[model samples]
Target chain A: MKNNIISSIRLTIVMLILFSGAYTLIVWASSQLTTSHGNGDVIYFKGKKFYSNLGQKFTNDRYFNSRPSAVEYNAASSAGSNKGPSNPAYLASVQARIDTFIAHNPKIKKSEIPSDLVTASGSGLDPHISVTSALIQINRISKVRGISENALTTLISKQTEKPMAGLFGPERIHVLKLNIELDKMQ
Target chain B: MNTEIIGVILSFLVVVILAKPMGRYMGKIFSDEKTNLDFLFDPLDKLIYKLGNIDFKKEMNWKQHIVVMLTINLVWFVLAMLVLTNMGNLALNPDGNPSMSLDLALNTAISFIANTNLQHYSGETGISYLGQLVLMLFQFISAGCGIAMAVIVVNAMKEKVAHTLGNFYYLFVRSCTRILLPFSILVAILLVLNGSPMTFEGKDTITTLQDESVQVSRGPAAAFIAIKHLGTNGGGFFGANSSHPLENPNYFTNTLEIITQMLIPLAFIFAIGYMLKRKNLAWMIFGVMTVGFLLLALPTIWNEMNGNPLIEKMGINQHGNMEGKEVRFGAAASAYWSIATTVISTGSVNAMHDSFMPLSGLFQMLGMMVNAFYGGCGVGFLNFYIYIILTVFISGLMVGRTPEFLGKKIEAKEMQIAMGVTLLHPLLILTGTAFASYAYTQNPIELSAWLNNPSFHGFSEMLYEFTSSSANNGSGFEGLGDNTPFWNIASGIVMLLARFIPIIGPVAIAGSLASKKYIPESAGTLKTDTITFGLMIFIVIVIVAALSFFPALSLGPIAEYLSM
Candidate 1:
């Protein structure tokens, strides 16, 4: 038993190095071949870097608003507003968001507002919103940026990502990338 | 079909196609048979054994195996504590995240070591890169430990019983090298190539297109995430877990993660058939588990797809329960993930359970409450075996015959252990929640922040924590503000007992069964592998889980649902 205990400790140490050290090193080496070079995909817009996959706050009138973030789009810590559906406070907050959305985009009706527009994502930094979510904000952004609605619509269509193999998952657009193109059009 | 429904079906079909070969391969590893990739693993394994000074040929009785497993797990616990608490000074602190507090460290260590991975602290700002690696180590070995113990139980079930089961070290090493490591590498490479980060760098400060500066946290996450799923250790590298875009980059990775997490638990079912040469029994168990799984999963998918009625009443075209869900996966896929992760004990969340529709939360909780549906890797089968034993005994009483399983008589001692193991699950979950409720009621002001949602939903948060802990299933409602000393220490104790007791109970039963004189099956003996017996096991599981947890369920999610 004593010998076994010693061996057990030794094995634990050896296995840790193999899994956590050597194994991670191999994966790291392989990451060097990827486009992001293992640091995560970065999109440099006007000399300012942004993680292409991570969400950013875009609440300015000139940019299409990203979804509401519980952490205010804090990339360092990801989380959700873990509010239950029946919680009165939570429901009221969603109502307030609905009111706020209607206030911002006066032409849009409350029924036209997709729930994703007002909801906080499970990851506070969700990069994409449904394609419908992107399109609804066009009226507000077009008025603010002085760009024609047709131009903004064309840009959103170009930035939209189809579901995998055109059948699985959801049709969505990267909010950061779409807004980046929106800014470049100016 | 809706794309959401199609995605859900595709994920399950992929797992079905993959389980057979993986199960066969795992069978070879466990039975000490040679395989095609063994040339690569054999030398690597030999070096491990030599360096660790392990006697690869030495066999151990069941008690020895338990003791050895615990001893090594202790080493891991200590290592985890040291690193987590001191990570502020550790070398890999590129983000300079401070070390964990003592209680949080204790909870984190126990959570990972037990393979429960109930995170009391968020991953990004909570621990350093070194701490992530240490927890990742536990992710690999703890799962290897579970698979090894399960193999021990399987060995004890052999018809021609041997005095000694295989060496714990040999089984442990082989489980890692032959089973976990190669598979993890495959997943890690896929994740890395598809844009999940895999670097030892600090967080990057990124200025948004809106000109807001936010620090984007990245690390050796792809490797961490790969084993996190493959080992069924669902401790995510980020607070939002797989919901984080980097942790699960896209729909393809989402499908891959769910499939990877569900694969091994199902594969182990097939492995049992291959090892025991009881393909009928394996199929029976598979049938029972799949039925239980779909019963939970299908409703959850339906619930999420129906959209939250409360939100719908707010004069909006609700896109299901998107409050705590991702757009890329949509409602059906996210709902599918919640049940799959819980049922398999992976606990990795692609969608936050707290924000799920009330009934959906109930289904998720029920999945954990009946943790044996497919369960975590090896331990899932162990939990299922307890139900099988109880079913055999109960049915024997009905037929007025001796309860014999696989030619071994199920005596009072084995029955006692089985009953005890079955009772422990509910006792731990209920008592822990009851205590927390008492404490909260006593000092509502002091513990006001313990719950994120009020009234019935708050009660569900507390109930879900203990349930997740006791089941060793780790996924939580997350709305529970659970980082307090009360939560950390309470759930820590629950996770420790929950993990070892179930394992010890089954191994002990299997060991005892192996030593008894074999009684040949006769017409009077019950056939455990038949569909009728599978029905009996399912009935027993439902009755046991329902009886124990129904009241708690009513108070928590069910009440919340009705109120809504």
Candidate 2:
């Protein structure tokens, strides 16, 4: 039993080392991920802090709106409240987001807001907003960049991933892609 | 689009078409129950025992046999690990696929040794030619080892004392030589005939249209691929995976691969039941497993069959949603491959699963939930024995009788072993997936930020993959660039542990039972016979799987469902 303990202990240590080593090697091999698409100036933001710089940095014309994100009272938190459309909290949150979105994009109609625009992602702090949301303000962004909303939306369509291998899920637009297209338009 | 569709069909056929003959041949080799093949190999067994001066015929009880097994199998494991670690130097010639890193080597070494072939690297570019033969060869051996252990345990449970607990050296040797080697040779040749390449050549260098010096991947792919499938250990030699024309090729080879993969495992079931003189039990086991496999798998095919909704709405119909799928075989073929390999612990992917629709993707994850239900080669059937024992135990408790499986009593100790075997890997998977999914939430990949809201869902799927991989069921539908160490090592270790630790439980129980006196198969023995026992066994398997993985499933697949 003592020998068994010793052998297993030695084995455990060896395994741990192997685990870390392999992981490190995998990490190293996957360094290609690090060298990909360069980072842009959309700083990670939280709660009301994000509202202060709304149009100052994220201009309606220059920056296409990504998904609306509230830090949800800023606790370093990130998860969808998991509330459904029927849930009051869900309704309240969606209403609040819609109000903010409408106020920000004055040129857009309240009816034009895509549901994904205001709805919190499963991860509430989703940095990306839906393409429809971006589309809601595409014309404004077009005015700033001197590109038509059609061209921008076309680019967004190209940038978007076809729903996870062609079928088995719903299609939605990506926020990061639209904003990047906005940057390229500039 | 055509490329993706054919690739899917080609791979799907590879699973179903190849599973039978190889399975039938393996069934005859492993069984103590007679076939002409066993008779021919009988002298070979005697030869090894005589030459080694060890009396294999010496009457030994179960405990002694298990101890011998522990030594032999464990020694093999260690030696295989050492060889894998040192394979870089051992290669006859260096191929484009370099030697695996230490973490990869260790994980891979143990994975093949345990007969759970979860790969972190692509066959063509990531692993060397030597690694394939040395590391991959071990999988075939370990699979045989699994059979040998089962044979020993089954014999130990027999009523009267036998002169032999099937000769380990003979069983292992004959298993590889008779069943695995011949089948692999025939299949490899057939694969080459079907256009799957089989050579020991290095990579072919090609000057691209742009005049770039790109080194195209080449190796003794078909040779190892033949064994890889026959052994039911599905690690692709290249990035194109089984979808690679050289590995799967046309529909003929595709069917051959599917048949071979299923044949080895299915035939073993026949072999085990026949050897135990319980052919009925064998069919029952197969029937129960097949029913569950179809239930989960059928939907996977149906759900993906019609094409992507987004594609329809957007009017992009040049091809069916062949996003991650191979066009050569199309939706039907890839969908079947997705279901079969996941259910069987074969992880070769023909389609990029990261792009599979939500439920189809979820079904793929669910296949791993019942992974032990129809796990890989040696591990899969032995796991069924534990499940069988457990079903008997639960039924006996309810029916007011001692739990006796095949007339051997299963008490508290056996229950402990069964529960451990059932639960240990799920814990690894659940916790690992939970941890990884949470990590994914923290770190999302920005694919031009095209990875919108569903990226987290992809992360959830990745968690499922790592869980599936580490747990020794190597099916991937969600696109995870697992060629990285984070995935490889984590998955590799999980694969190794999930594959081997469960065997320890079965072996220990077998040894313990071998020491006991066998009570006769009386009435009210809670018959492991009949469809009723099969149902009970199925229920126990389902319940344990549901309870262990359901919460995590709710977190990953369910979450993906709601998001989608």
Candidate 3:
């Protein structure tokens, strides 16, 4: 038993050094070759920095809004609302988001507000919104910014990321990138 | 078909196509047959064996295997505790995360070591990069340990009778070096190139396009996530797990994560066939697991894709239940992932299970409750072996003949151990939930903190926590405030017992069987590889899981479903 314990301890140490040390170091070294340099994909636009993959809150009406976040797009601590589908309080919050979306875009009907606009994503920091989610917010952004609705729509189409292989999953727009492009529009 | 459905089908297809070759590769590794990759891994494994003072060729009996497994696990637990509790003082404190409380540390350590990765705390804010690295280490070794123990059982199951099984250290080390490490490095590189972070740089305080400054938590997440899925140790580098955008960037990485997580559990099923030279037997087992998986998976996909009815009544026209799910992966893929992870005991989530339709939650819980349909790495087969034993014994009694498996007579001792192992799952889960429910009722006002949702759904939350822990599946309802002393300690104990007992029971049974005189098959003998026997095993699994968990299911997800 004593001999096994000693071997066990020795094995654990050796494994720790191999996996926790050598394995991770290999990954870290390989990551240095990527464009992000392992710090995450950062975009520099107009002297401001943003993580391209992480969602950010856009309270201003001039920019296309992101999905409702449980933590208000807090990247430091991500979470979902974790509310059950039938919870009254959660339903009420979704209703509240719908009402707020309708109020912001008076021209848009309540039925037109996509559910993604109201629901909080699992990560809270979801960077992309559904293509429809982005489309519904266009009226508000266009009305606020005085950019022609056509121009704004064109800009969104430009920022749209096609579904993987153009055949699987949803076609979505990266909200951060869309908003950045919106900023660039004359 | 819609792209969402296509995505789901694509993920499964990829897994099916890849699992066979990977299984054969694993077969060669465990049998010490030369593979092309051996050139790379042999030297590393030799160094590990040499440094550990292990005799790679020295065989051990089942008791010795268990002892060494437990001893090494003990060492890991202690090391994990030290690193987790003192995270603030750890070398890679880029985020300046505080050290864990003793109870939380205890739970975290056991959760990872048991291959149950059930997190009572969120990843980004709870532990440091050093801490994540240590936990990642446990992820690889714990899974390696599981595969090795399973291989020992495979060794015992061989046609020839043997006193000593293959050496545990050799199998364990080879599993890590040959199987897990190579795949992890490959997947980690894929993740890094595809936008998941792999760095020691802490939180990058980036200014958003809107001018709000927020701390974006980054780490060596690509490395962590690679092994996280590859090992079926679904503990995330971030609290949001694969659901986080950076942790699982886009649809490509999401698909990769799903594929990698399901890969080993599926491959292990095939490897058993290769090792035992019972390809038919493996195929039969695969059929049963696939049928069981589809029964749970199809409904979850339908539930999520149908969208929540209550929300529809509120004037929303969403394609599916998007609540607490990502837009890129959509409902079908997320629902597929939830069931896949649960059935395999991966327990990683691409979507928040708490926000799933109540019936989907039930299926997810059922996946773990059954706990044998393509379960975690090596242990999945071990769980299924218990079911196989029960089936053999019960069917034997019906036929008025002694039960036999692989020509070894099934005796009372093995049956007792199998029954004990089978019952321990429900016993641990129910007793733990019942105790928590009782405590919650006693001080409803004070203990209200335990649940985020109200009434029946809240009951489901507590029930899910214990179920996930007891199953060693590790995915939780998340709404449960489980970091409290009551949860941390209760579920920690559950995880420990649930993990070791099931493993020990199967190994012991295999050991006893290996030592017995071989009984050649006869006209009256029941063939485990036959369709009839497969059906019997499936029925036994359903009956056991259903009978044990039906009452608990009714109280939690079923009640929630009826009310909705």
Candidate 4:
């Protein structure tokens, strides 16, 4: 029994060096070959570096809203709220979001508000929103920015990513990219 | 068929092609036979033995082996708890993540130690880099322990009568050094090259295209992600798991991840065949498992591709159920991975399970419930072996013959242990679910926070958590608010009991069988290595899992599906 414990500890230490140190070094070296170079992919925007892969917040009325973030869009601590539907607290939060959305966009009906707009995404860093989510927000954005709804609709279509192979995932728009494009339209 | 179906077929083909060689190599390594990698590992193995004062030649009986296994795991659990609870003070925490709450720490420790990897907390924010490494250590050891247990069982089965199973320390070390290490390093390199982050630096603050600044988390993710799949330890480096663009960068990496996760579990099945020199028996067993896997997978893929009926009714020209899936893998690939991960007990996901169609959720849950269908490394075969025994016992009764397996009589003691282990799976899951249900009903205000989805789907979330814990398959519905003390402690207990007891029971049964006198084959002897026996085992597995879990299934996924 004593020998087993000793051996187990020794084995763990040996494997830890191999796995944690040596293997990590090997992977680090290999990661140098990728575009990110072991750091995440960064896109330069207006003298600022941005991680293109991560979800970003867009709270301004003129800009299209990003998905609700459980972690307040803190990419450093990515996670879901992990709140089930039955939980009154979670439901209350969703209901609150719904009310807020309705308050902001009186042009859209309450039932027409997409779930993606109110519910938090699993990552809390989901950069994309369903086409419906983007479309529902178009009226508010157009009204706020003084842009024609037709042009905004066209821009939404341009930003919409079709399902992979035309039959894979859902049609969605990158919220940050769309908002950025909205800014560029000025 | 579309490219999606082709990808699935190709993935299975690769696993089948690689299984024999990998299995044979593993068999040789565990048997201490001269192998191709001996040149590299031999000196290291000896040095380890010398430094640890372990006598490689000394063997232990089943009782001793299990004690050692449990003790080593306990040691690891303690170490993990200490590290996790003190993570805020630990280095490599560039994010300065605080230490986990006591219950969360305890749950996380047990989850990883048991090779379950059920995370009540997110990876990037909840744990420091050092903590991730500690979890990684557990991943390798826990997986190695499971493989060692399986190897010991195989050794017992090979021998007609033996006092000692082979040395547990020797097998455990070799499992890590030979099988897991080399495979993980290779996969890590591939993952890194394919664009996973592998750095010690802190989170990088970045301004998005919208001119909003956000801190993007990065870490030594590639190393952890590789073994997480290869070892069937499915805890994610990021909260979004493989769904995150960084964790699984592209389709190539996605395919690699799926294949890597399935490789060891499938290879272990073949290893059993090679070690026992019963190729036919191995094929039979493999065939049964594959059939069961396909039965679960095909429907899930079809259902997910069909998209949610609720969404379809809204005139949304739906392109499959892409709600929680990554676009890179698409519905077919994500569905394929979902089923594969669950079936093999590799709980890593490229898609969010919470967003899957109700029927798809049922199939995934069933995969874990009937965990014998090519389950986790070494443990999968052990679980299946229990079913094999049960089948033999029932067949013997039906035919009015004495039940014997590999010349050892299946007596009351063996039956009791086998039944105990077999029944314990659903027992823990159902009981846990029942308790949670009762609590939810009795104290809705307090316990209601535990569920994410209300009504039928919410019940499914709770059921899936217990099932995943009890099966040691760590994937979750994700919508469940499980970070609280109630879930953390309860699931922790379930994970520990579910993992060790099943392993101990099988090892005990194998040890007892090994000590019995050998009986020569005769005309009246039941042939276990035949297709007929395989079919019987298959039927027994299905019936047992159905009998136990069918009612729960009806209330959860089935009811949700019907409503949809």
Candidate 5:
């Protein structure tokens, strides 16, 4: 048993050097060849750098809203609220978000607000909103930005990201990208 | 014909086609036989033995094996704690993350060592690059330890009346080099190519289209993620886990991650068949596990796809409950991944499990509670073997025959250990939940702070935390503020006891049976490989799990589902 323990200690040292040092070094070297070079994908929008990979918040009337964030869109601390549906605190927060949304958009009924608009996303940094969520916000955005509803609808359709290969995930629109395009529109 | 259905079918097909070859390869690697990749790893393997001063030929009894396993694990725990506690001073802290509190460090150390990778703290801001690497190391070795234990059990079953099983150090090293290392590298490269970050860098500041700046964290995430899934160590590089676009990248990478995590656990089932020369027994075990998995998975998929009925009633065009799920993996894929992750003890998530429908949460909890549906590496089989023993004893008594398995007599000593190991899971989980519940009820202001959801689901959160820990399945409902001292210390203890006891129990039984005199097969001997025995074993698993956990489930997801 003593011999076994000694051997175990020795073996661990070898594995640590191999896994933590050598193996990690090799992977890091390979990452240098990728597009982000291990930093992250950066987008230059109107002279400002934006991480295209991350979810950005938009709460203005003239723009489509991103999903709610538990961490307030902090990429360095990405997380969910971890709130279960049955938690009274969580339910209350959801109710409040729903109420706020209803007050802002009188044309949309209380029931028409999608859960995605009220609930915090898993990453708290979800970049996309449901097609219905985007459409629901269209009336407000069109009226506020003085754009035609038909033109905004065309822009939304253009911004929609279909589920990969047409059937794996869900159809949705990227809010940050959509908003950037929305700003580009006259 | 739908893409989601195609995705599921293709994934299953790949696993099926690969299982036999992977099983055969693993068997050869562990059996002291010459294999194709052996030329690449043999010299390094010998060198490791030499450096460790290990006598490669020396075999160990079960007690010695367990001791060595525990000792090495202890070394790792201490090493991990040191690294995590002092990570602020360590190199590779581009984000300047501080040292973890001692309690969180202890919990993190135990969680990784037990192969349960349960994160009381989030990965991005909570840990530095060096800490992540340390945890990644634990992922590999802990997973290797599980496979090593399984190998010992297989050795015990194969050798009749043997005094020693096999060299623990040899099997441990070989498991890492021959199986885990090669596969992890391949997957790592695939992940890197698919855009997972793999560099030692700090968080980058990015301005949004709104002209507001945000900090984006990056690291050598691809390498960690590859083995995280491959080794069934589901510790995420980001707090969001695979749900993060950077970590999962695209549909192809998502498919690859799911397939890799499920592969080894599935292949281990087949490896048992090939190694023991009991193909039928392997198939029977596989059938039972797949049926249980499907039973859990189908309902979860239906619940998510049906969307939240309440949301539907809101006069909203329900797009099938995309609340906390990635649009890239939708409802079906997220539900599928949840079942896959929980059953295999690979707790990596593509969606927030806490956000899953009430019934979906019930299935996830059930998966961990059973803990034998193609479980982690070799431990899954170890857990299932307990049920097999119980089933054999019960069925043997019913048939008026003496109980035996693999030509060895089943005695009281063996039965005692098996029963003890079997019941320990629920005891730890239930007892922990009960205590937490009592504490919450007594001091709602203090303890209720840990719960995110109040009422029935809140109780489920506490229950799920314990269940995840005790089963060595790390996926949690996530709403629980488990980083506190109470939860950290409590779940740490549970994870340690749950992991080691089941492993030790199975090995001890196998060791005891190996030393007993082998009896020749006779007409009176009961066959374990038959469909009837498989069905009996399945029933045994279900009955045991259901009886122990059904009340808890009813209070949690069941009530939530009905209320909704």
Candidate 6:
């Protein structure tokens, strides 16, 4: 009985500590909303200490996203490419981007290609891929995560974005969403 | 382009044909197979009941019923929160699909429960198929329940009704199976045919034009896409969102999505009129809703097509007004779709809403804040009924008679229910948005350089997104790069309030509406059949929504519009 009492006391103390800690976090969080929002600086890359800026953060290892960035998509310079898809120049520019991605991710072949990787999405700041686009990158991310390539490829079938109605559109995968999963250690 | 328009028109016509048969089917099922519709859907109903473990023999008093309903939803919220927080360890595949943090978990739980699918995390990257299914599936059911209840309330009001307003369990099943299921399935298949890959294969390895290693993303996208649009759940898997081909593959698909997104809410009003034996009254309601949608859509498309001056300066092609939208759909469809989706509470977008010009953004926001025509399915009839009652009261007061709706008296008790139903949305939006905006500003350390706009336009876009998301209208302003703790939680709360308060309010109203003595239809009743009353109802909704959101509007999008 005495031992049981002691364990209960310990449990209560731990609960108190946890509850207090959570309360403090919410309070601190509420306090943070006072000034401004969406100034991209808030995002922290998983396990990376430094915050990544929208511009000038290109790396060879990471799959590049953000279509036709304008002034690095700075809010102060918020605007679009203003180039319609049919614009030959825009097509040429996007084609150049496709070539660049191919140059970086060498294993990906031209024949087994996802258009989203080569063509700039309309948002230009797209953070997703059509399931096909993500599928195109499955082999590379599988290697990175040290998982079997075949197994990871199977996961894509599970992850693709479905059309709004069975008859309306195509399935897609948010690139950021899919990549985050690809980067998972387990 | 014209062909696409015609295709969209045909798709809409098809949806219109489907709506009432579906609505009647919905009504019949609520009567629990005593009616023909329920009998048709009995097998599916039993399947859902068996899976959900509903006990029809168990009769619940109103209080216990509310308690169970509220408790179950809150518990689902807690479970959703747990799934999100542990998504890294529990659901994350490899390397690091961005895990749902405590904040995101909270946000997602609230968003789903509230029927607001405002995602703080990008799809594909932020969530797994498991997470989306577990969290967003609830949204599908919650939305169906809210809509089913609206139809149930209308049926309960029929003086000649033989049954208690339909069972919630049966309604949920029938709505999901008969109405939501077919549409979602049809749409998903269409999306797959349009080139959205429906696969379990992880990102594929393929050599690019220049050989480089890349991780391709993949999944069963067709399953969720259709419902996301039809159910008015606007959560997107990718950050580029609905505009991405996977979410919205082509122009034909986009037009179909746009029409279907608005079809149910518009048709529900007619279902309501039929249930009340007032076909002309339904037409009057349609006139107001149609006019409202056009007013919002016209200005938004106009501004978007005019093209942004800053982009024009770069000497880019402005032929079809290129901005943040898919090329296949072009600017016109994207803009038009944005208006319809946001206006009707189906917030699937093919363009970056924040990137829209000032007046355009305003109209869209106004559609959400005031212009919820019938709103979500079950919720719409409840909201409109409040306005209908309010109209009866004020007009009756002026003419010196007790206000009667379908022969029922509008007393303080009924007024209170309507008033609560009406005020609930604005209050939640105002309070949650204000709290969120204030909290977001305090955390300067989190803001990235690209997101650090000094103007209210920037601030207002963020504010508008919070309001919209929390209110469960998934349309967002493209200007705000929302992927942070402040937004994740704040928007989460907004989604919660947007979804539940309206539901709770209407459920309370429906319960009350059900219990009231049925007043038979009389010859001397005030004519709700006229456009005047319909406009009056629309105007009151506008006034209440506008008054609530005005101060916040001034601080956010309005200031941005002015600067532009």
Pairs with steric clashes in candidate 5:
A82-B479, A87-B453, A87-B454
Candidate 5 vs candidate 6, lDDT winner: 5
Clash tally, candidates in order? 0, 62, 0, 8, 3, 121
Q: Assess the local accuracy of residue B504 in candidate 3 as a C-alpha lDDT between 0 and 100.
A: 98
Q: In angstroms, how far off is B417's CA in candidate 3?
A: 0.3
lDDT of 5 by residue, B1-564 (tens): 556656766666787788888988888877777898877898988888888788878879999899888899888888988998999898889888889999999999999999999998878878999899889998899999999999999888873689799988889888888888889989998898877788787887877776678888889898899999989989899999998878887678888998899888888888888888888988999999999999998888878877776555545556566657766666778888999999999998988888788888999999999999999988998998889889999999999989999898999999999999989999998999999999989998867678778778888899999999998889888878888999999999999999999999999999999999999889999998898998999899989999999998898888987787
Supply the global lDDT for candidate 5.
0.85
The 0-to-1 C-alpha lDDT of every candidate, in the order given, reads 0.91, 0.57, 0.91, 0.83, 0.85, 0.58
Better of 1 and 4 by lDDT: 1
lDDT of 3 by residue, B305-356 (tens): 9999999999877778988999878999999999999998889998999999
Displacement of residue B494 (Cα, Å) in model 2 is 2.3
Candidate 1: which stretches are off by over 4 Å? none
| TM-score of candidate 6 on Cα atoms, chains taken together | 0.72
Candidate that beats the other on lDDT, 3 or 4, i.e. the better one: 3
Writing each residue's lDDT as its tens digit, candidate 4 over B1-564 gives 576777777777888889888988987887668997789999887877777677778889999898888877877888899999999997889988999999999999999998999999987779999999889988888999999999999888874689899988899889988898888989988877766788889887666665667667899998899999999989999988888777886667877888899998888888888888888888988999999999999999998788755544443345566556654466788899999999888898887787787888899999999998999988998999899889889999999878988788899999999999988999999999999998898988877777777788888999999999988989999878899998999999999999999899999999999999888778888898898998899899889999999999999988877765
Candidate 3 local lDDT, A1-186, one digit each (tens) = 898889999999999999999999999999998777988888889988888888899767877888889999999899999999999999999999888888888888878777888899999988888888888777888778888889878887888888789889888888888887787885
- Candidate 6 chain A has its poorest 10 consecutive residues by lDDT at A49-58
Scored against the true structure, residue A43 in model 6 reaches a CA lDDT of 28
lDDT of 2 by residue, B239-263 (tens): 5457554566544565567667766
TM-score on alpha carbons, each prediction: 0.99, 0.68, 0.99, 0.88, 0.96, 0.72
Question: Candidate 1 has what TM-score?
Answer: 0.99
Q: What TM-score does candidate 4 get on C-alpha atoms?
A: 0.88
Error of 2 at B183 (Å): 0.6
